[model samples]
Target chain A: EPEVTQTPSHQVTQMGQEVILRCVPISNHLYFYWYRQILGQKVEFLVSFYNNEISEKSEIFDDQFSVERPDGSNFTLKIRSTKLEDSAMYFCASSGGKPQHFGDGTRLSIL
Target chain B: TQLLEQSPQFLSIQEGENLTVYCNSSSVFSSLQWYRQEPGEGPVLLVTVVTGGEVKKLKRLTFQFGDARKDSSLHITAAQPGDTGLYLCAGIGRAGDNTDKLIFGTGTRLQVFP
Candidate 1:
């Protein structure tokens, strides 16, 4: 079905360290997005990318967070300084237009 | 802030039972999508409803979008244990914009017992 794929299914890092989550969206999908789900909380949007630039971002996406499409296939989300509250399941998604397909997710844990 | 409120946060039903989950919002959406997620996994899209008052059926599951585009419903007839999962409803802010992000619902967790 050509689904979105994320790397490092689980990530553990020190509170002050930097972390990068990687995703490879569907090859033909043009729009890419990042979303996070805190344990027991609703999934929250982080950012969306299209035409090689950020189209929209949520308030949750603050100074510490940044996204990059370093190459044609890889999209990455980097957190400059991780915080305990940043621990959550980060999901990557892509869509041709209307409905988006999501990856399994990267579980980020800050120690 | 756009919020999608899903009713009856949790539901438990025996096999062969019918159930419905509702997602409502005060803000209008161009399209609504329903997804199911298992533990430790991301949401898997099940259906997308674009037109107001549109109804689409997949197997034993039926989905409906409200006439005002502010709400949607999912109905499962003769649900089985395989249907147990967290169901989420997500809405796209604008109709034509290709860059609109999805606003997810609070979620409805259903446990269908065998």
Candidate 2:
């Protein structure tokens, strides 16, 4: 079965630095989403994208956060300036409808 | 903001035991999904319930959506150690036509011992 693929499964970055988490959603899937989970905490929604534009975003998705589908197959989330609170597991998901498949996730750690 | 509250944050049971997890919300959802996540990995889709009062079964796992579309339940029968993991219920957003927002539940950690 086709699944969402994420790169740099684990990343370690310093505060004030930049980090980009990449994801390759399932082919033919039209809707994309980004979520983050802090250790021992509930997963939180970040943003949702469709037709190459953002449809909705949460307060956590601040000015430092940006998402773009640079190409047909890739969806990315970039943080302009990482902070200690930014450390968490970032998940990317895609769905045509009904069921949404999620990537394994990119574990981001900020020092 | 719709919040999904999952019950029994942590569960540990012996093999062959049956268990159930619940997810509740005050807001209605267009659809609800169940997922399982192992340590060090992202959540994997287990099932999706689109209609109110819909029931779906996957082998020993059974999922049910509330009649009001504001809640759901997951029941596992004769669970094995392999069933141990974090179970989460996510609500699919319907605010827009192309809405892809999913509100995740608090999560239930089940440990089926062998």
Candidate 3:
């Protein structure tokens, strides 16, 4: 079965530096989403994208965060300035209608 | 804000035991989904329930959606070591909103020992 794929399985970045997490959702999927899980915390929704525009975002997805579908296949989340609290497991998901599929996730660590 | 709460945050059972995990919410959802995640990985979808009072079965696992659409339950019969994982329940946002965004439950960690 086709699955969502994320790059840079793990990343370490300095505080105040920028980091971009990349994902390649299933080819035929239309809806894409970003979510984060702090260590031992519940998964939290960050943002959702469809038709090349942000459909919705949470408070955690503030000014520092931005998402782009630079190409037909790539969906990227860029954080302008990383902070210690920004360290978490970021997951990318895609869905055709229901039952969204998730990638393995990218673990972001800020130093 | 919508919130999903799961009961029995952690469970440990011997092989061949039966277990159940529950997800509850005060707010109604258009749909609910169950997922399982192992260490060092993202969640994998197990099942999706769209209608109230719907029941879906996948081999030894069974899922049921509440009649009010505000809760769901997952039951595993004769669980094996492979059934050990973190189970999460998520509620899909209401229609006309960001329906794709999933409001996830606190999670239930299951450890089945063989």
DockQ of each: 0.86, 0.83, 0.87
Q: Which window of ten consecutive residues has the lowest lDDT sum in model 3 chain A?
A: A93-102
Q: Tens digit of lDDT per residue, candidate 3, span A1-111?
A: 899999999999999999999999999999999999999999999999999999989999999999999989999999999999999999999999777899999999999
Q: Is candidate 1 or candidate 3 better by lDDT?
A: 3
DockQ, Cα level, model 1: 0.86
The per-residue C-alpha lDDT of model 1 at residue B56 equals 99
Model 1: residues >4 Å from true position, as ranges? B94-99
Q: Once model 2 is optimally superposed onto the true structure by TM-score, how far is the C-alpha of residue A28 displaced, in angstroms?
A: 1.9
- The lDDT-based order of candidates, best leading, equals 3, 1, 2
Ranking by TM-score: 3, 1, 2
Give the count of colliding residue pairs in each prediction.
0, 0, 0
lDDT-best of 1 and 2: 1
Q: Quality of candidate 1's docking, in CAPRI categories?
A: high
Worst 10 residues of 3 chain B by lDDT: B92-101
TM-score of 1: 0.96
State candidate 3's TM-score: 0.96
Could you give candidate 2's fraction of true interface contacts?
0.90
Instruction: Give stretches of model 3 more than 4 Å off.
Output: B94-98
DockQ of candidate 3 is 0.87
